[model samples]
Target: MTSAAAVASPATVRPSRGLAVFWIVAGLFGVATSFLLYLEYVGQLTGADPIVSCSFSPIVTCGPNLLSPGGNLLGFSNSIIGVVLFWGPVYAGVSSLAAPGGMRRWYWRVYSLFIAGAFLFVHFLAYRSVFEYGSLCPWCMTVWLATIPLFWFTVSWTLREGVWGTGAGTRRVGAAVYSWALLLTVLDYAVIAIAAQLRLDVIGSLF
Candidate 1:
């Protein structure tokens, strides 16, 4: 009979440097962008024009978005929210890296859910930015882009590892998703861009 250690598969292993790097980049970008928005919010209150490099055009403006009511949904800047939430992935990534044995499956499962929520939130913000306001915050877009792969990888990895008590069938499905997650991420960006291009003349408005 096969021993327990011999039966164990490499697919059941935890996250690697690739997944960690994805989170690190996502968290760092989110923090940076949110901080910039905070600066923009400060400038708004001060009646000073924020000198942001991403302030490219009327359609690609961060100032107006920061000054809008949406910027302060809970009596505070959403950038504050970004600052707080964005640190999660960074902590997860760093901790996973630091631990010699790597993080637990349940921990990764929870982290996956956290990133999934972030993915949804970012999409909502994207909708508001393009359709509602007809403006795009370049920094916010960066967070959105980072979140795509971060969410995809976490959840897919969780499922592949059977963290949710998944069996072989589910593991196979998860493995497939993990394999194609990057391609799906690129397509996601494409679909969002197409939607934006259809709704707003993003290119035309730029020039």
Candidate 2:
């Protein structure tokens, strides 16, 4: 017979419930889009004519855009990469949600590194699609949109909460991120969107 107080309590981290919720929503959205992209990619590989429903225009076709050389740079569809890559955040988010207790210091650090890689790779692929492929996969763009916030806030929270390490510089930067994360994220997207307009003139070309 075990006493009621004998069982150990579950551990919890210090990050806010809001942060966990943010991780969950953002992670799930990215994963869902990535999964959709993967399905589209698979359809193309299998020679399916009706690959996806959103390919009614030249600049927004999922099939041709994904079948381009850039999509297979790794000898496979980049969406596959996205399917795998977005899971990092998904898992982290789930963990945070289930157990709001903060994760280990090193966990945040490692996540930051992984997201950094993902952030860079996404831009690389985006550039290839924009300039070389002359099109954009809507699903890919969704992943890009989700990833920006994921990376921004992940880094921001890690620094602000001193999850990785404690230091004056880290705290100072973290404070800045906490204050300006949303504005910076919006600005970052705005700059890229503006640049894309300059080169692609998406609206101008559409009309």
Report the number of the highest-TM-score candidate. Answer: 1
Q: Give candidate 2 misplaced runs (Cα > 4 Å).
A: 1-13, 47-52
lDDT of each: 0.75, 0.70
Against the true structure, what is every candidate's RMSD? 4.6, 6.6
The candidate that wins on lDDT is 1
Per-candidate TM equals 0.87, 0.84
Candidate 2 has its poorest 10 consecutive residues by lDDT at 1-10
Candidate 1: stretches off by over 4 Å: 1-13
Cα lDDT tens digits, model 1, 111-154, are: 88888898888788788877788888776777677788787777
Mind giving the per-residue lDDT tens digits that candidate 2 earns over 1-207? 011111112221345656666776777788778778888787777866544564646776677668787777788887777767777776876775565345666776888888877777778877877777777677888888988877777777777666656687896797777667778779877876776677677666556
Clashing pairs for model 1 are none
Positional deviation of 141 in candidate 2, in angstroms? Answer: 0.5
Candidate 2: residue 63 Cα off by (Å):
3.3
Worst 10 residues of 1 by lDDT: 1-10
